[model samples]
Target: MKKLVVMGGGIGGVASAYELKQAVGSDHEIILVSDNPWFEFTPSNPWVAVNWRKPDAIRVDLDEAMSRRGIRFIHDPVVRVRPADDQLDLSSGTVLDYDMLVIATGPRLAFDEIEGLGPEGFTSSVCKTDHAAATAQVVEKLCEAPGPVVIGAAQGASCYGPAYEYAFILETELRRRKVRDRVPMTFVTPEPYIGHFGLDGVGDTKGLMESELRERHIKWLTNHRIDRVESGVMHVTGVKPDGSDAESSTLEFAHSMILPAFTGIDAVMGIDGLSNPRGFIPVDEFQRNPTYANVYAVGVCVAIPPVGKTPLPVGVPKTGFMIESMVTAAVGNIALALAGEEPRHRATWNALCLADFGDRGVAFLAVPQIPPRNTNWSSSGKWVHLAKVAIEKYYLHKVRKGTTEPFYEKFGMKLMGAGKLRGQA
Candidate 1:
């Protein structure tokens, strides 16, 4: 029997491994490697930062959990991936060979790209459990002493949902603490406008998000490039529509959480033919790296081109629903490979997102993620917030059970005629 190694333990990686186990069954041995022993529910990170959800409650121990499913778990950081020899080097000084590899080590926070950014710098983050916990501390101090707040994404950054979520969630928390009036919040983003969400305004998202921000009494600046962040201040360069310099400004903040750019992990970077210059692995429609047929990728580590040209750099988003579709396609292809047949599965890469606004939220569905979708819809209400909580709990339950596709969820998706891959027949 051959062996399959899946890297990273986030939603994309864990879900892929679980689905692979269910698909291949006893045909192959599966191993999962990650830098952390726990799997984080990244969607709930915004809630965690505001103490709405506790860290331990959202974290699942990969060692105990994967072991229950008969999958080996390695909690060491990857030193390097020598795709040339089908070998993986780990920080623990061990090498492993795999018949197939799925690189899902999500985006490495490119904090160093900008001086004095990220957790160790001027602003805060919700990228990881520890980061959320640290930001929670910042939130508490901010509650005691309210002041101006700045939150948004940096140029070249792809994930914008979390930044928007942090802004609204933090606003909700401060109001709960009876300090909303004193704290002035401003959103800073590289997108030409609000609600671009890296996919070029899906289904009136631009209008909806802009209205939401206005209703919340939050100010916004678009086409903004973060030059640098220095203690309680951020230097940003505003770019015009024609990609020319609009102006430069320095914004002051009592508390801030600026999302930084993302890059591929060091282990997967600088590998010719395997990844793009930005360190993201380039995969075909089937999610397989062209150079290494046995290698596949999903989630933030996968390379996708920008939607269109913009004054500031803006990349596409790999939402959870889209990543699940990729994971499903990968599972089908791997199953085909185990049978010595050619792989034939391609991911649809659609976008179904839920943006919770503390007590209320917004939800959108873009069948193809890009604009002009056959299915493009958006709605908002308190029920969306409830749905977000429900999804968080459901996802955690499935993770603990090592189940990727429950029959009920799949049936529901089918009834709605959604969540199927592009080439599904």
Candidate 2:
């Protein structure tokens, strides 16, 4: 049997493993390795931090889930990857070999790059479950004090959705508690504009987000680079239109949350020919690593360049649906190769974002993910909130049930009024 090893047990990794099992059936041996056995539903993390959702409601037992689908699970962190030898050194002093390797390891937070940042100091993050819990406690204390709040993403940060979500959620929470007047909220981001969102303003997102921020009385600072975060104060230097230093400003806050930039995971960073200088793996249009034919990557770990240049940082946004599409394509190709059949690539990814706005929500759709034409659309409504809730519940159920079917694929097709995917023979 062909042996397949998948690293990381997050959403991307788990989804890939499940899809691999479905594609190859019981013919191949699949092993998933991760430091943690439990998979956290990352998208719901914002809610978890604010007491809207519980921790247990978003976590799942990966071992049980994968075992039921005939995939082996190892709760161990990968220390090093000897890609040339097809072996991996685990932190527990064990080495494992694989015929094929799938790198779904997510991005690593680079908090140390900034001065006086991270958990030890003034700001907090909602990127992880632990961070969220910690931030929740801090937020509770801040609620009692009722002071200034600052929220936004740091330099080179690609995942801007969470930052925006946290900002709006906090705004909504303050309104709910009737403390909106007591707290002065500010949104600071490295994005050149209000809603660049790393993908270069998707379908009026720029206008819509700016309008919403203004309506909510949320002050924003754009094209700003944070030099250091001190006690209750953030020092920022805004970039001029010509990309030069414009002016320096210092903003004080009682509580702050800033999303740090992400780099490639440590293991994959040291591998030659497998990753870029930025440590992101380079994959073909089909999501297969060019240098290592048997290696595939998905999610934020894959190196995709920015859509356009902005005064501030701009990056490609990898939504959940996009990640799912990549995983599906990779799994199908690998399964075909294992079955001694010619591999074919036939999957396209699009962006679907549902931004929650305190009492309501806004939705955006970008067919074919890339810009410069195609069907691009966006809308705002309360139903967007309902749809988000439904998606969360559906995903949680699937994770608990250990199913491999691509829910996003079905949902995307339904939205586009397209036909079903062609099943493998």
Candidate 3:
């Protein structure tokens, strides 16, 4: 039997593993390697940072879940990847060889890109479950002693949805505690505008997000690059449209959560053409690495260029929906390769997001994640918040049950009507 290995345990990795197993069944051996033993629902991380959801509520024990599907689970960190040899070296002195390797290891948080950033430094983060749990305690302390709050993404940071969600979620929480009036909030981002989101304002996100921030009285500084952070203060340099520095300012805060930039994991970095300069895996349309045919990648670790130019660097976001599309296409192509056939599947990189505030939220659907799309729509309401809550639970359930079905294709098609996706590349 051919042995196939999948790395990482995030949405992309887990989905790829399950789908691969279903495609080949017991005909081939499938193994999933992860640094951690549990699969944390990452989208729920913002809520965890505020104690809205406990850590346990969103994590699935990977070992138990994978065992039920007859997939071997390895809980060891990868030290290095020898793509040419089709081998992986683990931190525990174990070596693995595979006929096919799917690298779904998510991006490494580049907190060190800025001084005094991330959980180890001055600011808090909601990128990981552990980080979120720790940040939740900080949130409690902030509520007891209210002051200024600074929230936003740092320079080169791609993911902006959670930053926006955290800003509003915290605002809603503080209001519930009756301390919001005393806490002055400010949002600082590298995007040229409030909702650039790396896809250049998908579905009127610019107008909707700006309106939300204005109504909530959250002051903002767009096109701003964080220079550094000290205790209770952040130094920022404002950028002009010509990619030049304009003004310098310092923001004082009692609490702050800044999303840092992302890079590929150390194991896969600087491996010839396997990864980009920033270490993100470069994939063809079929999600297979161009230099290494057997190497497929998905999720945030995969590299895609920014949608447009801006004052500062902005990376494209691989939303959950887009990642699911990648996983589906990768699995299909792998199955074709196993059967000695040419690969033909290509994933549709659509973007779907449910950005939740505590009381309400916004939903965005872009038929194609990039601009010049066929369908671009966005709406906001309490229903959006409720839908996100339901999705979190459903996604966790899917993981636990080892379901291989793609979630986004059906959901997006129904949400936008079937006609939007018909006759597209």
TM-score of 1: 0.96
> Relative to the true structure, how large is the alpha-carbon lDDT of every model?
0.88, 0.83, 0.92
Better of 2 and 3 by lDDT: 3
Listed in order, each prediction's TM-score against the native is 0.96, 0.95, 0.98
Which runs of model 3 end up more than 4 angstroms from their true locations?
417-425
lDDT tens per residue, model 2, 1-425: 88899998987899888888777758889899998878998888888778888788888998888888888999999988888898999999999999998999888888887997777777998888878888888888888899999899888888887888888888899888888899999999889888888877777888888888898899999998889999999999999766788999999999999988888888888778898877898998778889988888988898988887777766777888888888888888898778777668745777777787656777776777778647566666677678778888999888778787778766665655632212200
Best by TM-score: 3
What is the per-residue lDDT of model 3 for residues 1-425, given as tens digits with 9 covering 90 to 100? 99999999999999999999999966999999999999999999999999999999999999999999999999999999999999999999999999999999998999999999999999999999999999999999999999999999998999999999999999999999999999999999999998888888877789999999999999999999999999999999999999999999999999999999999999999999899999999999999999999999999999999888888998888999999999999999999999999889999998999899989998888878898988777778897899899889889999999987778776776665644434432
Off by over 4 Å in 2: 415-425
The superposed Cα distance between candidate 1 and the true structure at residue 213, in angstroms, equals 0.7
Check candidate 3 and list the clashing pairs: none
Better of 1 and 3 by TM-score: 3
The list of candidate 1 runs beyond 4 A from truth reads: 406-425
